[model samples]
Target: AKLRGENGCPWDRKQTAQTLVKYIRNETEELIAAIENKDKENICEELGDVLYLICMITAINEEQGNFTFPQVVQGINEKLIRRHPHVFAGTRYKDEEELARQWEAIKAEEKREHRQAAEKREP
Candidate 1:
């Protein structure tokens, strides 16, 4: 937050989520390369870079009243719990293929529900 405060870095303060997309892509590619090469040090550094970008984007959105970082974290946490019912909710899957199929089905249902909710919210 200091980096974007009233007396903060002008460059950082000027950044928006749209402007940070390229940096996010670059950091993600570097992270993938680090993982592919099994470079633990580079992987850690790239992961931090990616996380920093996420925080920055979240901060920008919060500043614009779109959403906050905690909301984003909470949403993902809820999604993880929702999607991993086998581990979290005592749901069982026979095998990896079955688990994958169930996961896809859940994802499709979520998408359909989201679309319905969006349609209701529109107009």
Candidate 2:
């Protein structure tokens, strides 16, 4: 979203979410094709294009004061830590079933709280 700010590039400021949709999709398709063709050069170029578009849109979002890209990254980092408590919290899992159960229990509780918050916001 930094690129879409008032102080960002003029080209980014001109773009809307509607405008960049097909461009990103096309770049992803090209990358997939390059991967199937085993062309490292083409894949690299296409991946760069896709990443650029992602950054551009994120810059726009940040400018709107919704949330910054760092927030997005940090949220994911926190989620990884939460999900892997065996590593970060000294918790141990005896089996995959236990791990799955723990993950689902946490996710369901989080969702229930989120739903309650949303319901509270309703008139």
Candidate 3:
């Protein structure tokens, strides 16, 4: 983002999240195509592009004082650990279907918690 600072790249400096959304969406589509084509090299490149966009968005959010990158990382890490009790807490599922159902349930619970947190944060 230094490239988008006071004396940074004008192109990047002028870009907002709305402008970058298209690029991120395009990169996602390219990544999906690469996976469908089974091209390892293209997949790796596309994945890198997607990661770059994610970081860019995070930086933009941080600059706006909305949230930090660490918060993003922590949220995902916590969600993964919470969702996968089988892996993290030694809880077992009898089958793939059962595991999927449990995963969805956990996700719904997390969504509810997030909604409540947002409500609490609102003025």
Candidate 4:
């Protein structure tokens, strides 16, 4: 973020979420292409680019008081644990189809919870 401060690069300081999102999309495509081509070096480079954009976006949101980086990490960690009952809870799945069903159910539950929270915050 220092590179986006007062004495930072003029271009970097001028970037917004909208602009950074374009870079994120492009980097994602490059990563996908690298995977398709089985290019390990390009895959690593693209992944780094994607991570940089994500971090930059998080920093911008942090500046706006929207959320902290730790909140983002915590949310993903909790979501993973909540979704993977087979791995974390010793629950057995009969097959891939059953595992997928369980995953979708967990996702739907998460969506419902998010909607309820949003409704609670609405006037």
RMSD of each: 0.9, 3.5, 1.4, 1.1
Q: Compared with the true structure, what per-residue lDDT tens digits does model 1 show for residues 55-74?
A: 99999889899999889999
Off by over 4 Å in 4: none
Clash number by candidate, in order = 0, 4, 0, 0
Q: Give the per-residue Cα lDDT of candidate 4 at 58.
A: 88
lDDT of 3 at 59: 82
TM-score of each model, in listed order: 0.95, 0.65, 0.90, 0.94
Sequence-dependent TM-score of model 2: 0.65
TM-score of 4: 0.94
Order of the predicted models by lDDT, top scorer first: 1, 4, 3, 2
> Which one wins by lDDT: 2 or 4?
4
Q: For residues 16-60, what per-residue lDDT tens digits would candidate 2 score against the true structure?
A: 767999998899999999999999999999989998887777776
Local distance difference test scores for all models = 0.95, 0.85, 0.91, 0.92
- Candidate 3 per-residue lDDT, tens place, 3-122, comes to 678999888788888999899989999999999999999999999999988888888888999899999999889888988899999999999999999999988988898899999999
| TM-score for candidate 1, residues paired by index | 0.95
Worst 10 residues of 2 by lDDT: 1-10
Q: List the residue pairs that clash in candidate 4.
A: none
Please state the error at residue 21 of candidate 3 in Å: 1.2
Error of 4 at 101 (Å): 0.3
| Top of the candidates by TM-score | 1
